[model samples]
Target: MTSFAPDSIVLNRKLPLWYQVSQSLRASILGRSPQDPLRLPTEEQLAGHYGVSVLTMRQALKELEDEGLITRHRRRGTFIEPGVQRGAPVRLLGSVDAIVAQQSGMVAKLLEHGSSPVSGELAEYFADVDEVATYHRLRADERTGEPTNHARNYVRPELAERIGLDDLARWPMTKVLRDLVGVRIGRITDTVEARLADPETARLLQVPLLSPILHYTGVTYDEDGQVLDVAVIHYRGDRFSFTVTLDAD
Candidate 1:
């Protein structure tokens, strides 16, 4: 006999009134009462309970079914899918070069080099204090003389002020950061997302604009956990699939 509260429904920002109403009802079923396998009420029951039209309630339930959150049968009615939880290895950490070097050798190319004032996003990421100088941004492609992964990296200006752009074209930037700047590498945070390739990204990766690609954003930190560099890499979806080993425990 749990009571539904007025504030429990969340309206979808992009949808119409009926869709918003449906989203709210779906949220109640999937988010709040997920453990109650047999609690799915009929369309009329939900309409009266949520103060929405029967059609709107049905539309919301349909969306949930489309998302594979619930299933319906002739007489059995809709039921929540059992939750599945999994764990993965926590110790897997390394740079892209280090990981690839273990498998095969690859070359890094320095394509574009420039500097600009740190934006709000970059400032927050770098913990830049005061009016920080422009940061050196480099766009490079890593491969075996062919397009593999398109990468863009940003480095603090002061630390890389004396370094020549030609030096990066000849050597790995990690070496330059360690040997010249005297910054010790700490840890890197890597995030992967699936996205359709834009014109610029497609041109760099030698693929069509509508092609799918995996966007990898990596943030490198120094010994004090201060961000040293941020890299956005685009990898060809057909050629790359990341496999992470997980712990059963």
Candidate 2:
């Protein structure tokens, strides 16, 4: 019996009510602990919780059912699919330390690792080097084993040699770079935007084709102000939210 606060359900009047409600419910489903039972509240109860009509709640549940997230039976009620929790919508916090803390419990699986020639868009970042090490990894919630992030990393050749597969699978790249590789980080630049997932992305993330995703591009620079790594990470749009707070002077 997972519950959410009324304030937690922020509905944007500009968006379709059903869509917003579905997303909010999806977040709750994914955020729930695996130890919890699969059963969810009835449509009427859920509708009451969301302050939407039964019809609207039914529509929202249908969306989740169609996505293979949940199954419904007139007599059995609704049960979420096993091993399907996508974790909560991660709030992208400021500062490397905060970001690292946010990623603490995820389990990483190394997908691909090798050295590639520096060319195309990455050429500018590694202009001085002829080749760079590349890795592709899938990160999932340790508790539920539901995939949440797919990342491709391009590391500077010099630093990449010291990185081990075991480290990559166990820790975030930022941690590997700082704690293991002993690199001094001078700055990190990140840009986030919405994009539709391609076939590969959808397969890795267990989401539908062309589903909206949060695309993140990050560049890490060393103490000398040279690019140390370039990372591209993709997150399910429904499973993440970026947060930033500004202080008024």
Candidate 3:
């Protein structure tokens, strides 16, 4: 019932001005109700609402038109194309259970899986180790083909050599390491931060420029405090949320 009204979209500088207009308008169409009137605001109204030039606004509308999400009539005004699939509900989780519970929900596409150098901060952080087997996976919402998160995990080269990308795609690192490879786990630490979606990241996540996102860095350690593995996740804030409990101190 909540539509992305033009008044609600604030402009930002990270992306082209016209593209921002288009993104906001696209969100508007996706959130609109089926029974709701399909008429889009007039070009003048839109330009005024979004505080952009009519040329910029028109360019934005043209972008939407090219996408086949809407059409314009001689006198009837712009309208949402019938039968457009409503965007899926934003995924609301941050764990393996959500990733594996459904067969076609969240699956990782292995982009690169091989040994990578450990240098700079990571090298210092894992001073006891040098190189690591790295797997860069892009997780997507299969139903919508929208990327939900990107994960890059590192494991000891010895363990990495024994792990297969196919198995990693189907299971979490913890599961692969603990059950398949029989690695002993001790403790895991996760640090979370709020960040803006950079150009590259925004493209992968299909979100507008400067959209808020969550960056999670986690390290798994053995009993001896040697780093067993590390994982970094970039989650689209619009699609995922982290749930945590608090203890009164």
Residues forming the 10-long window of minimal summed lDDT in candidate 2: 1-10
Ranking by lDDT: 2, 3, 1
Error of 3 at 27 (Å): 31
Instruction: Please give, for residues 15-98, the per-residue lDDT of candidate 1 as tens digits.
Output: 344555544444343234323444466667767776778887777778667656567786766665554111111112233223
Can you give the TM-score per candidate against the true fold? 0.51, 0.64, 0.57
As for candidate 1, its clashing pairs are none
Ten-residue region with minimum lDDT total, candidate 1: 84-93
Scored by lDDT, the top model is 2
lDDT string for model 3 (103-210, tens) is 123556888887878968588556767688889888775446778888888888888777877876665676577657887666677788899998978888889989
What pairs collide in candidate 3? Answer: none
Measured with C-alpha atoms, the lDDT of residue 121 in candidate 3 is 57
Cα lDDT of all candidates, in order?
0.55, 0.76, 0.69
Q: Which scores better on lDDT, 1 or 2? A: 2
Better of 1 and 2 by TM-score: 2
